[model samples]
Target: MSTTQNERLRGLLEPLVGAQGLDLEEIEVSQAGRRRVLRVVVDSDAGVDLDTVADVSRAISAKLDETDAMGEGEYVLEVGSPGADRPLTEHRHYVRATGRLAKLQLHEGGELVARILTVDDEGLDLEVPGVKGRKPTARRVGFGDIAKARVEVEFNRKNKQDELEQEEEEA
Candidate 1:
C-alpha cells in the first residue's frame, strides 16, 4: 500500500479501535496469490480475547466498506492481537508485559533475559534470574539503552498468584 493509503487507514481505524478501548498496534497490507490481505493488529492493557477480536473485526469491516480509504480492491480483513512474543516497541508495550520474562538486547552490547518487575516513563526495573543456583539480581534499563525487546514465553513458570496459593495450602 502507498504511504497515503496507510496513513488513511490509520487515520480511519485508530480512533475506531480506541473507541473500543484498544490500541492500534499495526496495519499491514500484503499479497497472497491473487488476493490481498489487510491485517489489523489491535491490543489493550487487559489483552484482546477472541470475542473482542470478532467485534473489532466487524467494526473495521463496516468502516472499510463505507470508505474509499481502501481504494478499490477486494481484500481479506484479518484482525487480531499481537502474538505472545511480539516486540516490545512502545513504552505501553513494556508496561503491559509487567511480571513477564523478556529478552532485551542492549544498544551498548549485551542481552539480558529478565522478568519485568516494573515499568515507568524512564525505563524498566528487571529481575535477572541467576544461573547455577545463584540469587537473582536487580537491574535498571532505560528505554534508550534497549535495542530490541520481546517477551519470552515461560511454560512452567509459576505466577505470583499460584505461588501464593501454594503457600496458603502449606499453611
Candidate 2:
C-alpha cells in the first residue's frame, strides 16, 4: 500500500483501537496469494487477552468495511498483540516489561542481559546477576544507553513467594 493510504488507515484505526484502551503498535499490508493481508498489532500496559484481541479485530474490520481504506480488493484483517520477543522501542514498552528479563544492546558497546526491576521516565533499574551463586547486583541503565532491547524467555523460573504459598497450602 502507498504511504498516504497507510497513514490514512493509521489515523482512522488508531482512535478506534485507543477507544478500547489499546495502542496500535503496527500496521502492515502485504500480498498473500491473490488476496491482500492487513495485519494490525495492538497492545496495552496490562497486556491484551484473547477476548480483547477479538473485540479489537471486529471493531477494526467493521471500520474498514465502512470505508474505502482497503480499496476494492478483499483484505484479511489480523489484529493481535505484540509477541514477547517484540523489540522494546517506546518507553512504555520498557515500563510494561518490568519484572521480565531483557537483553539490552548498549549504544556504546556490548550487551547486557538483566532482569528489569523498575522503569521510570529517565531509565530502568535492572538486576544483573553476579558470577556463580553470588548476590545479584543492581544496575541503573539509562534509556539513552540502550540501542535495542527484547524480553528473554525464562524457563524453570521459580518464584520464592509462589513456592512459599504452595508449601503453606500443602501444610
lDDT of each: 0.96, 0.94
Clashes of 2: 0
Tell how far residue 133 is off in model 2, in angstroms. Answer: 1.5
Best by TM-score: 1
* Each model's backbone clash number: 0, 0
Candidate 1: residue 93 Cα off by (Å): 0.2
Leading candidate by lDDT: 1
lDDT of candidate 2 over 59-127, digit per residue (tens) = 998999999999998889998899978899998999899988999999999999999999998899999
Worst 10 residues of 1 by lDDT: 67-76
Shift of residue 149 alpha carbon in model 1, Å: 0.4
Instruction: Estimate the TM-score for candidate 2.
Output: 0.92
Off by over 4 Å in 2: 163-171
TM-score for predicted model 1 compared with the true structure: 0.94
